[model samples]
Target: MAQLMTIARPYAEAVFALSQEANSLAAWSEELANLATISQDPAMAAMIKNPAYSADQIVSVFTEVMGENLTKEGKGLLSAMAGNKRLSALSDVSEVFETLKAEAEKRVRATVISARKTTVEQKKKLSAALNAKFDAEVEITYEEDASLVGGIKIKVGDWAIDGSAQSQLNKLGAAIAQ
Candidate 1:
């Protein structure tokens, strides 16, 4: 995972800079996402790893599968990625690029899991809390997990706050056993 991030960083930065320059962030974002999905397919992976298939073959298959309606610039980017043998990293690049773009737009995603269905007010308050904590524009998604029993679990990026009753019970159980 670390190596994938390392390999994807430069590509993400370069694409982001180009998007800023061209003011076509949306187009590029969609194109990269589609390309990433294509590159991640098992058949594509086999093709990329197979010594029998040439780079041109890979590119040809990608172009054909991607259809004929793509912009010339998008095709050019795909060709460049294929030529450089970076197709396998396309998904990683796309993911990191989306994160970069979201950061640029002052948007963050937060996952909130609660014991039961939450009201609109609850979601709004949670979003407000997360926005206040991170000082960023937050988009919160809510989920109901009955196993949690009570309280909530909030995750933002790599950070998680597990205040779920089940979690505390498990911890207490471990402590008692020890």
Candidate 2:
């Protein structure tokens, strides 16, 4: 996964630069998402991996499947990746692009899981706190997981705040056993 991400970083950065220059970040985001989805499809994966199929064949099939959805630049990206046999990196590229977009827009995505559904007031307060903590606009998604027992866990990117009762108990158990 890390290697794929590393391979994708350059492509994502180049695409992001192009998108910024063209003022088509949102459009490219959508196109990249579609391309990623298409690339991940089992049939498409098989075709891409099959040595019997040439790069041109793969590009033609992908273009046909995307139909009129792809802009000229989108087609160009497809051709470049296909020519380089790096189509499998599309998903990582999309993820990296989204991360870049979010940072550029000063926004962050977080998921909050609690033992019960959060009240509107609680959600608003948490969102505000997250925004203040990150110094960016927070886009929060709330989920209820009874297994958490109580409190909540907040996940933002690679970081997680585990404040649930279950987590506390596990920590206490480990400490006592030690």
Candidate 3:
């Protein structure tokens, strides 16, 4: 997984630079998402790996499947990936592109896992707090996990704040056992 991400990073960065210059970040985002979806399909995966299909043929099939949704730049990306036999990296490329897009837009995605569903007021407050903490706009997604027992666990990017009753108990247990 890490190696694939490393391999995909350059492609994602190149696309990001191009999109920035073209002022088509959103369009490129959608295009990368669609390409990743198509490339990750099990049938498409098999076809991509098969030696029977030439690179041009695979690109044609991909472009045909995309229909009018594909742009000229999208076709170029597909052709390059096909030529390089890097179609399998599409998922990672999409992920990296989204990360870059989020950073560029000054937005962060946060997940709040709680024992129960959060109220609208709670969500709003949490969102505000996260925005202040990150100095960026926060997009919150709430999830329920009864195993948390109480409180909430907030995850944003590489950081996590674990404030659940289960976590406290585990910490207490470890301290006592030591």
Q: What is the C-alpha lDDT of each candidate?
A: 0.86, 0.93, 0.93
Candidate 3's residue-wise lDDT over 1-178, tens digit each?
8988998999999999999999999999999999999998999999999989998998998899999999988898888888998888999999999999999999999999999999989988998899999999989889999999999999999999999999999999999999
Which ranges of candidate 1 are over 4 A from the true structure?
A: 67-73, 174-178
Report how far off residue 83 is in candidate 2 (Å): 2.4
- What lDDT tens digits, residue by residue, belong to model 1 across residues 1-178? 7887888888888888998899988988988898888888998988987778877888888788878656677677667777777778888988999998988998998899999998989877888888999889998888999999999999988989999999999999999999
Looking at model 2, residue 123 earns an lDDT score of: 95
Best by TM-score: 3
Clashing pairs in 2: none
Please list the Cα RMSD from the true structure of every candidate, rounded to 1 decimal place.
2.4, 1.5, 1.5
TM per candidate comes to: 0.84, 0.92, 0.93
Clashes of each: 0, 0, 0
